[model samples]
Target: MANPSHDRDPGLVLGFERTVGDEVQAVARSAGLVVDVVLWMLRRGGWSVGIGCGAVDEPMPASPREAAGPAFVLAREAVEAAKSRQRMVPLAVRGSDEGAALDAEAVLMLVAATGARRSAAGWEAVDAVEEAGGTRQEDVAARLGISQQAVSQRLRTALYDETRAATRAATHLLTTAHP
Candidate 1:
């Protein structure tokens, strides 16, 4: 059974609902008829196909198990999107416990934008660190026989490049929105 409380409400964001619905429809099409029935139930129960908000008093579920199938799929898509650098707004309830939930929401948005896979360099770095059984920058550098300074420089460069890319994207968005 779908949980009504877990439904997404995108509030005043026009087109967001349709965008979400399209994503659901894609998933439904992929999963065939069984999942389509689940999606239909979720939509009828107030879950937005895109962005969803939590009620001030009623919070979204913390675990995936607590969410309806469509809501879970939407959350997963949002997370992938965010990881891919797509812009998305996360829905959160108002409370202390809601902070983690909000973070989860943001993660979903990122995933929906990006994907499960990290960049090649990012994966390489992570793999190297894991193989060395050391997570610290200096330790990883030592295991790789490189100076910590070099590792730091590489990391900084990567960060700067990503920052530049993000800045350009933001600028483009602003220009398009105003123009």
Candidate 2:
């Protein structure tokens, strides 16, 4: 099988390896999964995987001013790839200090938000809000006289709930369509 890393950009390749290395180490220590072999399997399975900076990298900067150029580049790439439907995982290597951990969390949250938006449920809520003339979360909240946080929370919840419902509906439609 072709290596998923073969055609990927050099920076992305490094990021992937870095992320996978960290996850593998953690999984081995805590979950009993071998880091190397799992990565090998994933690579063979055609997944475009990239690793986030693990905790083992340089200390997290006190502010964005302190972050390394490469670190920011990798984070931006990972976030963009995730937004575009490419699978990106941030790997936090073992021994990463607390600061790095915080940075990793922020990156992962960006990935999750992207994933949520890509979901069918997410699109439905987005569509609904747009149809209702709400151009953005803040706009929606303003119209409803609620906090932006509340609007965000409601959008997320509605997306999840609607996605589940849509999935069921699709399944039923498929079943009946074929029957």
lDDT of 1 at 125: 52
Which segments of candidate 1 are over 4 A away from where they belong? 1-104, 107-119, 130-136, 159-179
Clashes of 1: 26
Tens digit of per-residue lDDT, candidate 2, span 53-170? 3222356433333345443444445444534563343222211233443343334334333434454544444454655663776776666676778767756764544543443443
lDDT of 1: 0.36
In terms of lDDT, the best-performing candidate is 2
- Give the distance in Å from residue 165's predicted Cα in candidate 1 to where it truly belongs: 20
Question: After TM-score superposition, what is the CA distance of residue 49 in candidate 2 from its true location, in Å?
Answer: 4.7
- Candidate 1 on 65-170: residue-level lDDT in tens? 3435433443465445433542332222111233433443443333323312345554345446535654788887787677777666655544534533443443
Pairs of colliding residues, candidate 2: 15-51, 16-50, 16-51, 19-51, 52-91, 54-92, 54-93, 55-93, 55-96
